[model samples]
Target: MMTGLHLVIARNNYVKKLMGLSIFQVSVIMLYVSMGKVHGGTAPVYVMGENGEPDLGVVYSSPVPHVLMLTAIVVGVATMALGLAIVVRIKETYGTIEDDEVIEKDRQEEEALADR
Candidate 1:
C-alpha cells in the first residue's frame, strides 16, 4: 500500500512537471507569433486587381518570426516526445521514476555491491 501511494505521488509530480514545461513552451511560441504582427500591414497574400494582376502596393509584415516559430514548435514537439518516451522506459526499468527514490535505490545497490 505504501509503495502504491508513492507511485501515485511520483506520477502526479511527473504530470505537474510535464504541464509546467508545456505551458512554458506555449508562452514562448505565443511571443514569437505575436511578433509576426505589424500595426498597419496586411497578410502576405496577393490581392487581385482589375486587370487580373496582383496589386503591388500591399504592405505585409515579414513572415520570418511566424515561420521560425512554426519550425521551433515542430522541433519542440519531436524532442518532447522523445523525452517522454525515455521517461517511460526509465519508469519501467527502475519500477519507479521518482528522483528521490531512484537515487536512494541506487545508493542501496552500490552499498550492497561494495559489501560483497
Candidate 2:
C-alpha cells in the first residue's frame, strides 16, 4: 500500500537524520579532546635523577583537554537525551513512527477539524 511505502521512506529519513546528528556530536567531542593535549609535555611522574634530585623541569601534560572532554561527554549525553525525547514526542503525536505516516495523519486530522 501507499501508506506502507510512505512509512518506509519516512523511517529511512529519520534514521539518516539520527545518524548524521550522532556523527556530528562524535566529531565535536573528538575535536575538543584532541585540542586538550600539550605538544611536548612530559608525564606527571616525579622521577629522581642520578644526582638524587627530583627532575621538575619536565612540563606535565595539560589536563585541560581531559577536563573539557568530561564537559563534552556530559553535553553529548544531554544532547542525545534531548534528541531521543523529541523522537518520542514525534512518535506519540503520530500513530506511526514513520515520517510519511505522521505527515499523512496530521494532514487528515487537519482536514477533519477544518470540516467540522
Q: For every model in order, what is the number of clashing pairs?
A: 0, 0
- Cα lDDT tens digits for candidate 2, 1-116: 33334443444455445655666666666777677655445455555657876555544455777777788778877877787778788877774556677788889999999999
Best by TM-score: 1
The TM-score that candidate 1 achieves is 0.68
| Model 1 Cα lDDT, one tens digit per residue, 18-105 | 5556666767778887777665555557576688865546545568888888898898788778778877887887788676777888
Backbone clashes in model 1, listed as residue pairs: none
Show model 2 residue runs off by greater than 4 Å: 1-12, 41-61
Error of 2 at 77 (Å): 1.4
lDDT score for candidate 2 against the true structure:
0.65
**Alpha-carbon local distance difference test for all models:** 0.69, 0.65
What are the TM-scores, per candidate, against the unseen true structure?
A: 0.68, 0.59
Candidate 1 local accuracy as lDDT?
0.69
